[model samples]
Target: MGTTHDEAAGPRRRSLLQAAVGGSAAAAAAGATTLTGQAAAAPAGTAAAPRSGGRFDGESPRFALAVLPDTQYLFDADSADPDPLRATFRYLVAERADTNIAFMTHLGDVTEHGTEDEIELAADTFGELDGKVPYSVLAGNHDVSGSDDQRGDSAYLRAFGPDRYARMPTFGGASPDGYNSFHTLRAAGRDWLVLALDWRVSDNGLRWAQRVLDDHPTLPAVLTTHDLAWAEDDGEARLSDNGRRLWDGLIRGNDQIFLALGGHYWPPGRTVLTNDAGNDVHVHLTNYQDRYYGGAAMIRLYAFDLARGAVDVETFAPWFLTRDPERRTPLEAENVELTGPADRFGLEIDFAARFAGFSPVPAPEPRPASDVLVRGTVAYWRFDRAGLPGAADEGAPVADGRVVRDLSGHGNDLTARRLHTSGDGALTWSAEHHVGQPAHASLRFDGGQGPDRGALLSTRRDAPLNATRFTGGYTIETFLKLPEPFVGEHAWMGVLSWEGRSGDAGKTTGWSTEEPTCSLNVSPERFLQFVVYPHVQDADPTSWSHALPVGRWTHVALVNDGRRTVMYVDGSRIARNPTQRSTGIATLGKPFVIGGTQFAERYGQGFYGWIGDTRIVDRPLTPRQFLTPYR
Candidate 1:
């Protein structure tokens, strides 16, 4: 219950609090309460009224949680003023839709003394959010009579006990002594638990917290308490004596407890600790009572973005923000937003992987080959059949002459071949594939460009795909992932190409006469290049894409109608597609190559990455018809 400030500067009382109390009284006399609307229509026992449109979209991948900490000075009995806290609640109510706020939490210290007048005043002010937003509050050292939860029946308990939240949707259950509680919020297509613990939890209280976690074993838990850590002026926080006991008793062994938040410390700080499961547990301290106007009821927002695997934090004072900018004091302007490292930051967490231990996300099953064989499909090849006679097993090197049958029921089979100076390990089968890919496996090529050595797969000389040209339209689609640290030698690698040079095909409108007629290649800058020599015109329509991300799977589609061609990366059209008219692919009736393009009818450096399911159609197909479904 004590802090370093108590030892260094006598007591915890600040002259700033006295000044803030007098100023708050003057602001209240000036009709500041009119800034916020009337109190909530319903009390704490009814269903919350929805906003203008509807309730917040909890199922969205992006949502926010609001945190209010240490508002004791504002609720001191004689000098109490509820305008600041009311403004914060009003802001949460108005911005609920835009922010997608799921729930709000109060880290205790709601009043300076455990008196009925102080607790009742705080309760009446909080009525502004009774049915508007779901919130939970716990007792702090100042809220109680400097005793643990074992000392029951206080004014704080009578005002904010489990009975006050029994009808709320998020309220789960409370301990028998009524000092601790837990709530479950449905967000991000799942449930998240928020545990509110008393200032000084007794042994029974600790057991109650454990029981709550045991009941909901799979849900991620966030523990909120009154005092856990303290920080110096440098904003580096360390565990207090009570914080260490709580960590050893509750947080260190619970893998589901990924975050712990507390108040009762100034100049908010944070630190990350490793749990018994070897996972990071973020412990943060947030309290602004020492700032201007008792921190003006500042709110800290935790914006959880599941798609980005990050929780972005921002702290600001809604009360100060409502003031006229021209009339605001220097302190008020400075306290509008906290830009310090500890106040605004992002926590990088792979949510799926981090929660896999308790609740595993099932991997999608492999789709049947027939599911993706569209109407105009000419050839479709997948490297998923590992145990077949001619196919290589997962992690095994592909044989020199492995024949991969075309799944389109056409005789466009491909044969694997090793380059002159490459080893048997040049090509291998892998189980890594994109999440939305139909196939569950891919081919990893260890190719480079020093002496032009690698591996490739090519259709036979007499294959029908080699002779036939798609005059109507064409669609080429593939899934690939480049290596993380793509080396310089792997630059200008080819993914797929039609064998034979454009000069041999009687076409000259290209960068180089020796280049393949139709090829999909990666440039030195990691941009995708789709260059095609058409039969109807002498122009080569080239489509260049933005730089592809390294170590990430990407779906590429090259669609050409009867007139023009368009290239799509991950279903989005690139910006650099040429406007040149292109109709039929110029073929030399020799062979169609994959994994590498030919220079002067000879294979050079092969593709140096993992390639998944690839398909080519005779007519142009929309993005929805591609192998991977586009959202």
Candidate 2:
């Protein structure tokens, strides 16, 4: 799906997430890279992380690291340019936030006036994260703003490298560097919990958060710090302020204190409430320095899933024109219902070392210390997006000979289409049929987060192509949802992508975008989802995720090794999308039958639902090599 830079203009397609495993199949028709240039280079290909947000392995040992609270950016009160928490710090440098993420702390001020160059550009962008995801930082009050601002506390300890108090390696092991320490960490596999509370200093982070939750009363603890304790018993010395009697003695004595992340308080708390020995706690308050990129119009994606026992909340903002609609509305908090059983252990995963290694990749950032390119030209507007010829007016293939011409999308059906759902929402489409069948435009419309119906037959492209230097290695396959028995189905479907990092449709762009995607569903229980992109703002790569379902369909793929992203689901493999800033030129607009624009008027948001027997192939396939070519 990559055409439309004006074969006469107006139906645009181009956002296969910028391809390498998929769109680079042309690399802008032979130039190798230069759809235009927003640059920030580091993915000429390889070291992975660019497939398309989904999977990073799981049988349920469970893994996550999308945390960012009390994070700041400011920009210029005393010299602040933290570029608005660079969109959740590019999701903590492309997620895994540190694999089972038993590490990652910030309940500090990170920036308000924490100057010294906004604490060294937020400690060189959190030192570019990805040590699997290990991190550490603390210094709120806008990074030492009180006590008469102790002279900017030595520029927030030489730029957030750590000071106001140290110690955070499982807490007390091999280091002696912590602000209030006590760590035990092992991660998804087990061991759980760690505590790094220093709240500047007073009541001194509740006696090391009560000797680190009395030495882990049943595991899973997380009491990093910035502060939260006001239930009005009038303690008022501020900071952890007694955080409501240490959150009611760790919520009537532990279910593992749940989670209480905080920041320096900007538009902080709105309500996290949870009680009755259900023990689930949540205070998570954030927004500082002006609140990065789309600059604090609100931002918090939050989660806590003991295998779906529940606990999920959302609160995005940045459609701009703000002054407070509560920072432009959008506080969707509801679905945290998994109810019972969710501790699977991701299955000791050795799968013989995952079928034979190929995982090691963490040594890059040491090249000449900063090319400083994340290239610029945002909000650019020069649409030649594809139709380029000049080697003497080239133009003639594409009658439909299987597809492939590159250098900016080119004529029609660029390849790729599939979507099917039902549970009373119906949706189908795999075009021209044969290979698993489809041609109904399928259907889905239940609403409320699912069988929330489906339907996608893509060809207009637009999955994130700002126009070139689009790095390489790309792929995308389909089929997932495999499992039926719902003449009255219950909702779920798959296949939908956008990677372009969309924006515009009511306006908003404070940064952070992976662009609404979805795939592999129909689970009585089985997982793989990309429903991300909103570490606080920046969205509009195009969008896809009609709720995916249709039972027993199985198969899914995405392999862009530009910087991290590799999600498969049937041929096994699951999740990974690490830092891929789209290259553009992959559309699906207007109603060219829902994707051709200039008419349907709503492309990126409506297609109805249904897909089957589709194909976007060029690479990444392997469920016995895509069922041995469908037998």
lDDT, candidate 1, at 80? 85
Top TM-score hit = 1
lDDT of 2 by residue, 273-355 (tens): 55545433555444322323423323333333443344344333212211121222222111001111110111122221221
Distance from true position, residue 65, model 1, in Å? 2.1
Off by over 4 Å in 2: 1-169, 173-181, 184-192, 195-207, 210-247, 252-256, 259-476, 479-615, 619-631
Judged by lDDT against the true structure, how good is candidate 1? 0.83
Per-model TM against the reference:
0.83, 0.23
RMSDs, each prediction? 6.9, 27.2
lDDT of 1 by residue, 72-107 (tens): 889888988888898788788877777888999999
Angstrom error of the Cα, residue 103, model 1: value is 1.8
Count of clashes, each model: 0, 139
